[model samples]
Target: MHSIGLIGGTFDRFHAGHHSLLLAGLEKCQKLEVWMTSDRLVQAKDSRILSWDERAAELLNFIGEDLSSSLSINSLEDNVGPAPTHSEAGAIICTSETRANCEEINLQRQKNGLGVLEIIQAEYVEAHDGKPISSSRIRAGEIDSEGNSWIPKNSRQGVITLTKEIESKLKDPFGILCEGPEDDLSVAILGALEVAGDGASPIIGVGDVTILGLQLVGINADIGLIDEKTQRQKWHGYDDINQSNFDNILNCINPPGKLTPSLLDACEIAMVNYHNDESTLIIVDGEEDLAPLFLHPLAPIGSVVLYGQPHRGVVLRLTGIDSKTRCRRLLNAFSSE
Candidate 1:
């Protein structure tokens, strides 16, 4: 066995694939040094990517039980990390995407008058849909770390009722409540925005008031859903909100307390547009109160979903794994017909 083996990656969301890669390296070497890409590098690609400490802590927790003594996790600041210059490094484990970089490392080692290190290929893990599982895919709400989709098949095919059995759970805020007087809506909107943060992946507004407040403040959402009513009554002058501001406008008939197939279709389309860097406005013919149930699961990680609570305030939900899991569970409780 090699004295020491090296493995490096962003390792953003520790998954079965990451597990396999680490194990692959450990089998061929006495010790494995895992170099995790720094948060500074990952943020440029997806701000929703977990920080170094958060990712490292979770990774260590997973492998700490039996592999603690054989593993050493370090932050990778640059592309090659220390692989090119490290004196004691023996072999490097890499995925298909990073194989070329490993070869380049050997070239650098040759120039440094050092022997070439072995480049071992790691096992690849695929999601249920036969695609490789990736952090970007998980962040997009396509699949979980185990490669399972959060959305159950055929769940969106028909109308799903928000039954009274789960009404209390629905009423409970899934996110923080930013309370404010109705007259001065800015207080609540601004407060929620602070929590949402400027670095949030995508800001989505799911109510007429929430969309309006965002528009009036010039901080437009990547996707906005509006039913043109508030508190089960006509939001007077809802038309005053500009439709031209959005790159595309889609309409869906999502009756009060019901998630229609059309609503699901519209949301999926909006998410596609969001990926394409286009802004969308989904105008609902019925109430949009229950829309959050779908938004949390459909949105990518780091997305901020905002909706207004009549006489209360704006609710801002930072979409993440926990929120997505909760949404999936809540969706399972819906009565489909």
Candidate 2:
């Protein structure tokens, strides 16, 4: 009879590292058993594992239908899994990080009078940054399955605020200007209130009235930038806005007509949350009128940023290569402080 082998893991994203470990396990035994840890166990570790069925399908596809016949897949209810109980299993496969668990399984086997299985430890897979490949790092968006960066660190570096010396260049408008509330400007911008030109593009409302107006027109902004005031007047309904259904609410201090470091950090936090499909609100202590200073350049391509045009109405700026270039030039026009 073929010697039965055991392997246990969360197998969360099932990347190249997982493939290496499984291949090594398959080479060590004619028949291999994979114990995909239960949802509770995975949650205890990271709380964000892919569903069990998805992980199982990925493992089976990696093993191939022909080799899968000799593979036994089961849910591991506890850390020990079936390794201590499987009488005929003669080997356990794991990475160096999990080797201690294998040793504990063998100790349990000794207590139960079962034979100690050989432990096979797989080498760690390193990313382009020379860090160990892990599911948490994948979820954090540090690297892809092949360990390549989605975007280089320097490419996403934060924007620096410009000094006040070049205020002359900032007076001109960059996008189409509308002259009314959400419903009025919605028609002017050609369905921009609900979504951008692309239906799935995220809308970021950068002023108090802009956010409320978008909601008035049945368009919920993915990210809202509000300072609890309208046109420099203390808005009456701060309590109501505080009760809105935002997944996260953050505060930043940015005085009128200037982009501060705190404002940049808050914008980055909101953008990250938006990419993760979470609704976020940036509650500003001072003026949020000039938020487009950072919002236009920082938002993802295809995103739409709406800010109040004062007494005029709302202005819609589509984020793209051209828009970012214009915003950068305008920002650089200001004196570097």
Candidate 3:
């Protein structure tokens, strides 16, 4: 009987390491069946590298029509159930990290009266720096000098393009000045709203910019609004509040006590009452307010705030404070800009 091999993954973009593994598996098995994860499963796995259609198309392109004719490519995860199992193939090819999962698969096969499965473990390719190269690592922008060499020439350009795009989107406008601990929320909201207002341009600040960029993409926005008042309202009432007194006064005034006591209780008192006397006019503008709020203790008022405006734009802002000084510093920075 001819032996068949089964391989599965998101395969967002087929790389040389993947090509080598498939070829190695085909050499050992008479035929190879490639199972692509379903779109839903891909999302569940947090494999946002690409859309399901894009991933499938790329895989088909990589395998080509000739080899793909013999290779079965289907989204088993979508057809079957959650965490779908593979059929009783002759063997399954997987990486060392997923070896345990392969074992579990074989055990399931055994229970189903299918004989033991042959497991093919592919050796991990390392970059020049001896660091293991993986799709996740590459996606995370960790491609070092050694890792770049191991990448296939054909795929390198695409990877570079993707990396550049992500980097561009993640750039911070305020440069390294946005790195201050207290300025995180202000920086994130400002950056996101700016992108939503603009045409997906890059900014410079810190990781907050990247976080806001991701949020904007979810809303399909090009730019966002900034509502300093609304942002302040939300933060003043939240617990573990640690912002400047000036920010607190701004939050209290802009939304004009729009904050709920429960929220304030959750955020603690210092953030709400710190700067009761400061004169600050909260600015309300942008579309970032449409996005869902990621609640957290001492979280910047508008740190996770987003507003989506159809055919217009999104707005975001910052509110609340742990200290009056920090809030003033952030506002000063904004004014200076």
Candidate 4:
């Protein structure tokens, strides 16, 4: 019914909620002017935010060339951009979070001797967990773009065994292999430290060598999984790993080639307290090698998970969409009880 409706947001990780907002504008307006936050402006909120061009491209891809004429993406320098002064903008679409700002924009428009714009509040999109889907949550690695949670709801109740059929695939490295000498693991540890420097949330260290090397270099992982073994043999220097350094010490039985519910529960507990940043150490009774398969999906996007590769050295794995998906696929391949 409106000629030109305006919608504004960062749309950084574009999720189901973003799509719904866009849909609300398209349904009521012939043309929608989407004011997206500029890269520089959004950086203060989250430095990992995609560039303006990248965000625009995602918008264009979703709206498609056929509807391109109906949609326009403008850079948002501030909360209200040209909206208060624009005589042509007849209506504005926003979420409940921004409703107050839109109301203020209308008051400013009236002050400018322009017609008051109609404000439409878009419905929220909820994730599988029944919470509102948001870019911030997506960034935290809780759910996918479609609002699907990366961690399965009923998955924490069973034991998943890495069968021989999938063992060959598991042998292949899932992340960056920082190859170095066993005697001097400085290169590999430093490599992981560099990755951690990128501001990933809740850096997880798995395996004895990986944690020991990081500890020696004074790099404390937000969460560490250790079994006091390297290459299926007990490492004599595991006593060097200071247990008191971690605030919480969790113990679970995750035998070799199998991931247990106890282990998953521990990961969930640790992650739920991510905001507090309570550093945790999970001392497994068995192998922690297979833990990464679950850790990737549970940790938020941009999370760093480090583990050793036997004679090869350390593997620096940063959890992202592709890596999380791959980890889920491998997780499904496991024979579960």
Highest lDDT scorer: 1
Model 4 Cα lDDT, one tens digit per residue, 129-217: 79999989888888888889676544565887788878998788878888888898778888766756855666789987887788888
* Model 1 spans > 4 angstroms off: 40-45
Per-residue accuracy of model 3 over 229-304 as CA lDDT, tens digit each = 2333443322222222122322211122122222223223322232232211122222122112111123322233
For candidate 3, give the lDDT. 0.43
Candidate 2's residue-wise lDDT over 214-246, tens digit each?
A: 665567788899988987998764554543678
- Backbone clash tally (model 1): 0
Backbone clashes in model 2, listed as residue pairs: 163-335, 165-335
User: By summed lDDT, which 10 consecutive residues of candidate 4 come out lowest?
Assistant: 149-158
Which stretches of candidate 4 lie above 4 Å from their native place?
Answer: 195-200
Q: How much does each candidate deviate from the true structure in C-alpha RMSD? A: 2.0, 10.1, 16.0, 1.6
What's the lDDT of the predicted structure labeled candidate 2? 0.73
The 10 consecutive residues of candidate 2 with the worst lDDT sum are: 151-160
User: Per-residue lDDT of 248-328 in model 1, one digit per residue for the tens?
Assistant: 999999998888888888988999999999999999999878887778888888789999888889988898899989888
Q: Estimate each model's TM-score.
A: 0.92, 0.52, 0.45, 0.95
